[model samples]
Target: MLCLRSRTQDAWLQRAIGATRDILVDHAHCERKAATQALMLLGRFPDVTALVEPLLDLAREELEHFELVLALLQRRGWTMESLAPSGYQAQLHALCRKAMPGKLVDLLLVAALIEARSCERFKLLAEHHPDAELRDAFGGLLAAEARHHAVFVRLAGRFDDAEAVRVRLDDLASAEVAILESMPPLSRIHA
Candidate 1:
C-alpha cells in the first residue's frame, strides 16, 4: 500500500498541487505549439524519413496530452486563460542558427533541454501534489517527458556532427540559464 506523507508534508503538497494545475494548463499550450513546429520541420526535412517518423509520433502524443489536459481543466471547471509566453522557448529558438546541419542540431538540443526541464518539473509536481489523482497524472507525464528528452538526444546524435552538437548544446545551456534567470516568478509554467 502507498503511504501518504505526513500532515506537514501534505500542507506543502496542497501548495504544489495548485502550482501543478497551473503548469498543466500552460504545458497544454506548449505541447500544441511544439506539435505544430515539429510538423513544419517535417515539411522542410523531407529527405530524412528515419528522423521524421519519430517526430511525427511525438507530435501525435503531444496532441493527445494536450487533449488530456483540456479534459482535466474542463472537469475542474477551469476555463483556459491566456498566459504570458515563456522566455525559455523564445531563447531556445533564438539559438537556432540559420545554417544547414547547425539548424537541425540546435533544434534537437533545444527540444531535449525543454523536454528534460518539463520532466523535472513534472517530477517535482508529482512528489508534491496533495491530491492523489494529480500526483499520478504528473508522475505519468514525468516519465513520458523523460522519454521524449532521450529521443531528442538520440536524434540529435544521428543528424549532427558530435563536436558541433556538443558546442551548441553548451551554448544553448548557457542561454537557457540566462533566460530562466531573467524571467519573473513564472507561476509553475507561464510567466
Candidate 2:
C-alpha cells in the first residue's frame, strides 16, 4: 500500500472534476516536475552509481507521462499554459534534512510519498470521475505511478537501514498528510 496517513476526501475529487481543464494542466506540470526531480537527484549524487540507471529510467518514464498528458489535453482541443503552483511540494520538501546521506534518503522518501499520493488520486479519478476519457487516461497511468513509488522507496533504502528509512518515511508521510490538510483543495495534482 502507499505510505499515506490519510485518504483524499470526496470533496477534493469534486473540486478536481469541476475543474478538469485546470486539473489536466496541473497534472502536466506535475509530470514535468517529477522528471526534473529525478534528474535533480542524479545531479546531486553523481558519485552514487546505484542511482544512475534507475533515476534515468524514472526520468524517462516521467517525461513519457508528461507527453501523454499533453496529448490528452490536445485531444480535448485545449492548449497548455502556466498555472500557479499549489505550494504542496514546497511545504513537503521543506521538511527534508539539510545534511548528506540523510538528505539523500529524505529526498527519495519525499518523492515516493508524492508518487504515492498521485497514485491514490489517479485511482479515484479512474474509478469515479464521470468522464470516460479521463477515467481511461488515469487508469492507464495508475500502474506507472505505483511503480515509481516503489522505485523511490527502494532507492531510499540503499542509503540507510530498513528501519531507519521506515521511520523517516513514516515521519515524512505524517508531515505530508499535515501539509495536505493545511491547504485548501484545488485542481492542482498536489493541492
Candidate 3:
C-alpha cells in the first residue's frame, strides 16, 4: 500500500484534467526532476555501496519516463516549458532533519511519498481521464511509480532500523497530509 496518510483531493484531479496540457508539461518536468534526484542521491552518498546501482537504475528509468512524457506532449501539439513552482516538494523536503541517518531516512521516505502520490495520481488519471490514450499512458506508468515507491522504502531500511524507519515514515506521512491539504488546486502534480 502507499505510505500516504491522505488521498489526492478530487478537486485537484478535476483541475488537472481540465488543464491537461499544463499537467502534461508539469509531468514532464517532474520526470526530469525525478531523474536528477536519483543522481543527486548517488552523488551525495558515493561511499554507500548499496545505493549506487539502485540509484543509477532509478535515474535511467526516470529519464525514460521523462522521454515518454515528452513524447506525449509532442503528440498533443504541446511543448514542455517552464512552470511556476507549486512548493509541494519544497514543503516536503523542509520536513527532513539535517543530521546523517535522520537526514538519509527522511530523504528516502520523502522520495517514497512523492512516488506514492504520483502513483495515486496516475491511477486516477488512468481511471478518469477523458482521452483513451492518456488513460492508457497513465496506466502504463503506474507500475513504475509503485516500484519506485517500494524501492525508496526499502532503501530507507538500509540506513536505519525498521522500527525507527516506520515511526519516521508515519510522522512524515502525517506531515505530507498537512502539506497536501494546504496546497491549492493546480494542474501540477503534487500541487
Q: Which candidate gets the maximum lDDT versus the true structure?
A: 2
lDDT for each residue of candidate 3 in 1-191, tens digit (9 for 90 to 100): 79989877788889999999999999999999999999998888788889888889999999999999999999989998888889999999999999998898899899999999999999999999999999999999999999999999999999999999999999999998888878777778888
Tens digit per residue, CA lDDT, model 2, 1-191: 79999999899999999999999999999999999999999998899999999999999999999999999999999989998777898888899999988999999999999999999999999999899988999999999999999999999999999999999999999999889888876777787
Q: What's model 3's TM-score?
A: 0.98
Error of 1 at 7 (Å): 26
Write candidate 1's Cα lDDT for 152-175 as tens digits. 777888877777666667777667
Candidate 2, backbone clash total: 0
Cα lDDT, model 1, residue 11: 35
Q: Which of candidates 2 and 3 reaches a greater lDDT?
A: 2
Q: At residue 59, what lDDT does model 3 achieve?
A: 94
Candidate lDDT values, in order: 0.70, 0.93, 0.92
For model 1 the TM-score comes to 0.84
Per-model TM-score versus the true fold: 0.84, 0.98, 0.98
